[model samples]
Target: MRRIVPVLALGAGLSLALSGCFVNPLESITENLVEEGVEELIEGQTGVDIDVNGSGISLPDSWPSELPVPSEGTLQYSASIGETFSAQYEVSGRGTFDDLVSKLEAAGFENTGEIEYGGLTSTALETERWQVSIVYIDGEDSTPAALQYSIVDKDAP
Candidate 1:
């Protein structure tokens, strides 16, 4: 009987662990490859550098000095979208990545994809010609932050 109990317990634990492997809607939206690719594209076009440490993405020296100051728990970065350029930053806060998603949705930004990079989960959003991203730091008290960049087009009709 004791052996059976241990076996059952082990099986139950394995089941629970496996159940968590299912893709969550929020996770799906928070860690996307497409968004990462877009970010890379923007960085390449603007010649702006990005250094994403565990804390957040560091702003490059070439960044404009007049960018808005991020909230206490937020970090911001600049990038280019298509033709019109913009700045993107991240807002880190109390709640986990889930909280950031709620705030973004509340702010009228739609979830696009999920991106897992540098041991963090980044949620991506876009508005017409702009691309924004928010990354959730796993075990820190830092607030969620976003990446805001613009798209530039010289020949617009």
Candidate 2:
């Protein structure tokens, strides 16, 4: 666990710092790299068989394949339908959320503020092609922090 975390962090740092290398024509590969990296990390670290397309959640027949997932987290669940993708993940490390915010801001995503409903908190962001929201509950007592992420293709309906 200890060794894997540093490798994950290093991969994420490189991915963010050199993100443009995977832009445009190679965009879909970026998503593949992200998913594959996570799977490898989990398998190497915890011996868990992480599934790529095995989330088993219902999805649209034609969902895009370019959506990225976090490289250093445990995916609890995932689903896709229409032009939307949604997932729950157990993030490790203290600044994982902050790193996400920084990456999104660097990508020119507008932070449209936050929303609270039904005892859950969400931070919303928007880009030309994607609208994203991360809903979470901060840890308290014996409960650990829980996070859910949703992304939608803004151009699709």
Candidate 3:
């Protein structure tokens, strides 16, 4: 847990930085080099393999098969640590949160908790192997209708 947070931070930072990082095709090469350098530095410091596919973010290669790929949003950010993953997205239209909930239920997660406070909503769901939470983070520090989500491996230690 102590070592994994920086990898998550790098991934989140990349979510915001990607647009500015890739200004043009020619500069994309330099950006890739910079990205690699950052990955190496973070890996050296934390030992987590922090791979962030920015701009057009997608699920990590190791994304657990049981998890649903979110269908309602542009991929804003994703990071994987072994089998666990965290992702954020800028959603579209209405019912995006419900869409996420329905998919997780279809994947066998049971709704374990829900809360609405301070004008934000969040839901938590879980399975024998995993637990997930999705929360609205659309005001102030986030994009409109954005969702922050994560799936934790129950057996991770």
**lDDT of residue 102 for candidate 3:** 94
lDDT for model 2, please. Answer: 0.60
lDDT of 3 by residue, 11-113 (tens): 6546544646456888888778777776676557655555544655567777787678667787766666665678877776337788888989987889999
The residue-by-residue lDDT of candidate 2 on 30-129, one tens digit each, is 6667766765664465433334432353323344555444545666545444456666666654355666666777778899998777645778898889
Q: Which stretches of candidate 3 lie above 4 Å from their native place? A: 1-32, 51-53, 139-142
Question: Given candidate 3, what's the lDDT at residue 68?
Answer: 80
Give the range where candidate 2 is weakest over 10 consecutive residues by summed lDDT.
Answer: 53-62
Q: Go through the candidates in order and give each one's C-alpha lDDT.
A: 0.44, 0.60, 0.73
Candidate 3 local Cα displacement, residue 75, angstroms: 0.9
Deviating ranges (above 4 Å) for candidate 2: 1-68, 115-121
Candidate 1 C-alpha error for residue 55, in Å: 15
As a whole number from 0 to 100, the lDDT of residue 109 in candidate 1 is 62
CA shift at 21, candidate 1, in angstroms?
Answer: 40
Tens-place lDDT per residue, model 1, 27-111, is 6454344345444543564443333222355545544343223344444333322233334444444243565466546667667
The model with the greatest TM-score is 3
